[model samples]
Target: MATVILVRHGRTAANVQGVLAGRTAGVGLDAVGREQARRTAERLSVVPLSGVVSSPLERCRQTSRILVARQEHAPGTQVDAALTECDYGTWQGRSLGDLAAEPLWSVVQTQPSAAVFPGGESLRAMQARAVAAVRRHDAAFEAQHGPGAVWAAVSHGDVIKSVLADALGMHLDLFQRLGVGPASISVVRYGPHRPDVIATNTEFGDLAWLGALGPVADAPVGGGAGHGAPRADEPAARKLAP
Candidate 1:
């Protein structure tokens, strides 16, 4: 199967304001969010993408456009409803601090599988549809562009977390353990045997090695000389910009 890059949309006013934007219309990326997307684009410009799919929200569409703009091949972009934000229903536009006081908040924090927004979708249902959508697109890209093809999916935080949890073989209830910050990138490749999680919640790093990735085989013994040794003056891993 093809490799899929899961990109969470950059920050928005709702994010800065600590409010749940949910599927509310017209919620687009703010200034910092646009800059974050641009930085993400710079990181991804080294690799060629087969396509870019985004949630049908302004934030994700804007991020997708920025990403495609920096792509070496300028992959086409499209919208996928399945990749949209979780339907927070009554929770939409509510302050996070206020929602934290609701009884359901504890359930959402402790066991998301059983958490369902009032008049909205269940967390389990969200994971199911998102996993299905990602796998479907992975298969389509693999068939159309071959196994080495790469693609991007620009979506919401919770949506991407659920997809990552599924890819990691973690249960829905444990998905909250993962943290996906604004504009963070996660990489996954579906194989015949299992899905390989190449990276998760990455904000800074050189991704040019992705262009040279081989077939999705079993993990190399002893980690197999990862991405090559760093240069003498370089740190073993990149430090997040302050």
Candidate 2:
């Protein structure tokens, strides 16, 4: 098992303009986005992350760079195709206001399981691939590092939300209930038995508590994790996975 920190890239020009920048190439982070990236980097710097992976999108890559730069010994961000933005097909670069008027918008919101972006993939496809990708990366890192390994994936809002919904054992259609803001952090502890949703859509927090135990420099293994949370135990979390 491993703890996966899911981060949505900072706001982009498209985000500011309410455009669906889906897989539209060259759309980088805007000014506000840079600031969010910097703050997120500073906030996550305390944790000894084993690896950083990101979607193969420029905005996500930009956000990943800021985070990797602040880490003491984090591996450079790996651009995983699995983490790419949902292929919105004809919807790419379209305005949100325009999409809102479309008949399928309601299906997307109320029954995402049935949503298929015109000329693109279905929501169920997006959920399956994103979940598998994150799970694969999480298990691999933990196997290489140890039971207590941690990593982060910088991805799109819907992708992260779908993953969280699965972790919470909620249906894909209910995923809209989960939110992921730009540069926000959502954590999940994936175990052999089940997954735990640690936090969701949080903008800021001093993760000093992350360094409070096991393989963490200041605190020794077996020491309790501070900030009122229990220690992170892979084997123990696995017992709850089912």
Candidate 3:
């Protein structure tokens, strides 16, 4: 059971403009977006990634390239359409403030399972395909590289959130409760019993600990010792936000 790190693509021009650029062509990462990706890449550089899969969108491709470049031995970026952004259809290229006025917007926020973009796909369909693609790739990586292997999936915010919701066994309607920021990392390891949500929407942390982790059948009953043992002088562990 390899661990999959879900990485949302860096911010884009559309993001700054509050526009939905769903499935739109030629929308690349903005300057701030590039910097965000580079910072994330620097954080992940300490760990060796066996595979790096990304959405076909330009912004994601750019972010993936940065991530692979920083890795010591990251396999080249592989594109997967199933990980692409949800098609916003008539809502594409529209500003968020504007889209909020649409009748379907309420359903999208409250009950995504029944929300379908006009002339595009439904939120339920997006989650199904995205989850399937991630699981498929996880199984393949584990079989080829062994269970200790780690991989990455660079995708859109909603796509990643949907996958996270499914991993957490939450219904699609509650998916909106999850927040996936640009260049953030969320980890999920598929185990025999169930998927473990290791981290979610993390912007900063020491992920080097992951390199030493191996597959486990079940989570520790008491949250297990935090990663590795604490240092002798380290004060009693206190919950810290990352």
Candidate 4:
């Protein structure tokens, strides 16, 4: 089986300010975010990684750099637009507080499955794109390196969460229930069948404990449910399929 490590980008100014970044440019990691990346790098450096991939977004690219730098393996790192964050469209750069003032905000919080960002993407669309991106990564790595290869992907929170949900066969409307903290690491192993999650929302400090024992941690809790949470009784209205 090939191991895939998914990392959420470090915090950003927008994250701190609680603004929607969507697909807008100019959003980059804040200082705390940088530190988070560095810590993650320090933890993953010991893993025998074969490759590293990142979203074209600046924040994810920067996080990938740090991760690659910490490794002695000198793995290949590439950028892929498929891993980009969800497009907020008109919501880009808008504050949550401001958006909350609108009636649409309630719809997004309660029924995001049906709400679409004005002139932007739907939650369903974001999940589809993220699932495609993850499958591409899996296919490429398996073709080039075969089983036992370990690869890392650096991306945004929403993108990472969506991909994780897809791996677990969860639906997109449940996306809000999953959370990927800054620089958090989620792991999955791919074989002939569906991918299996090793962990989700794992902190950098947890990596050191895992590394001390071996390259990977014990099988994740909840059998790949995002962050160890139980699966929803009813799958979300929006599927994570492409």
Candidate 5:
């Protein structure tokens, strides 16, 4: 069996503001977000991680960096686009309240499978992309590190839940039932036959008694120094398109 640790990125301004950031370029972790990531890193220090993979999104990338930097593992941690948040499509940048005020938003919440985002992706599309990414990551880890290799993937809340739902063999419509909080950790095991979930919605500091390290110093929270657009060479995971 191979252990996969799924981590949701720290909180972001968009998250706190109730805006759908999707694939927006500038959205990142705020102060509280940074602390969340650091705490996550401190907690996972006890796991014998062989590799760390992250979404190219600033939020997940930042969290992955903090975790890996604290680990004794060697360099070359991978950043892939496969681990990205759901593309909110036309809903990107719109506040939840504003969207809720619109009639179409009701359809999205009530009938997501059939409701299409005006000029954007549907929930079905988002689930497909997210599930594919998780499968791909699992295959890659199995091929490279063999069984029993513990790997960590830092990604978005929605994305992580979607993946968990897939692993659980649940329907896409039940995605809402899986809660993935910022900087929270979920563990899954992929064996020769099937995938099994070990835990969910776990906080970093809560595991301090497990002997995991504490948060690092001066790590940027909420958001980090802004960067240019996500690298073009990276595979496209779901994104909030323009």
Candidate 6:
């Protein structure tokens, strides 16, 4: 019922070094990341946010802080584990170059639904949980703030991508084709008819339009189970790469 704006956390040292980072603690944003977070915050400052939800990681929390600080009413920030980085398991802290050598790496890229990190969660599991968390929060926030209210969730790149894939109703394997740069913004509004993706991986634009509430610009009202289905002309799904 409400619009949830997904913002991937700013770049980090691990990002610069090309490490998986995973759930490793103390991975704060690098200098470039701090600036990215600030710029993203500034871009969103003109809009009114009901709240800011962040992954329970230093990077996401830091990013959330920057965004909430710039808001007029300064919406409160809360930590949600559902938005945390996908547990990379043994791959944690390993450089992507080295991970690329592993046999499972290709599976991760092409068939994530079947890929499971040794000693950690599968990509499919990550996507499922992340989507569920987002839906749960969307319902809660909509109940609290009303249909037109806007909120933000600061999360990891993969986590946000997975959420996008779910919102688009795409298979998890296709998520890699979707790129989520650090500090990018993706917008989604869950209505009675269907979930509408307003924007994705946004760099810059006027967001004041999102502050408007009640009755989305497009999409029809609800009727039944298929009410959320896209229009006949709408693509069944959006894919990035073959």
Sorted by lDDT, highest first, which candidate order results? 3, 1, 2, 6, 4, 5
Model 2, residue pairs in steric clash:
193-241, 193-242, 194-241
Candidate 6: TM-score? 0.88
Query: What digit string (tens of lDDT, one per residue) describes model 1 on residues 1-242?
Result: 78999999999999999999999989999999999999999999998999999999999999999999997678877899999999988999999999999999999999999999999999999888989999999999989999999999999899999999998999888999999999999999998888999999999999998876767777667776576443334454542322
Better of 1 and 2 by lDDT: 1
- Predicted candidate 5 versus true structure: per-residue lDDT over 1-242, tens digit per residue: 55678899999998888888988897778999999888888787766677888889888888888888777665357887767766666778889888888887766655656666777777777778877766677677767776656788888877788788888888767777779999999977665566766578888434322222221123236654323333333357722344
Considering TM-score, which of the candidate structures 3 and 6 is the better prediction for this target? 3
Worst 10 residues of 1 by lDDT: 233-242
How does candidate 3 score on lDDT?
0.91
* Evaluation by lDDT, superior candidate among 1 and 5: 1
Say what the RMSD of model 4 is: 9.7
Say which candidate scores most in lDDT: 3
RMSD (Å) of each candidate, 1 decimal: 6.2, 6.5, 5.0, 9.7, 14.7, 8.3
Model 6 has an lDDT value of 0.86
lDDT of 6 by residue, 1-242 (tens): 78999999999999999899999999999899999999999999988998888899999999998898898898877898988988889999899999999999999999988999999998988988888988888888889988877889889999999999988889888999999999999999886767888789998877776764346545545632233334445455632222
Weakest 10 consecutive residues, lDDT, candidate 4?
208-217
lDDT (Cα atoms) of all candidates against the true structure = 0.91, 0.87, 0.91, 0.78, 0.74, 0.86
**For each candidate, what TM-score against the reference?**
0.93, 0.88, 0.93, 0.82, 0.79, 0.88
Q: How many collisions per candidate?
A: 0, 3, 0, 0, 10, 2
Q: Residue by residue across 1-242, what tens digits does model 4's lDDT show?
A: 66788999999998989888877776788999999999888879767787898888888888898888888878998888888887888888899889989887877766666878888888778778877877778778867886657788888887888788778877766767888999999987665656677689988444432322222334656655543233344356523433
Question: Higher-TM-score candidate among 2 and 3?
Answer: 3
Stretches > 4 Å off in candidate 3: 230-242
lDDT of 1: 0.91
Stretches of candidate 6 exceeding 4 Å from the true structure:
217-242
- Using lDDT as the measure, name the better of candidate 4 and candidate 5: 4
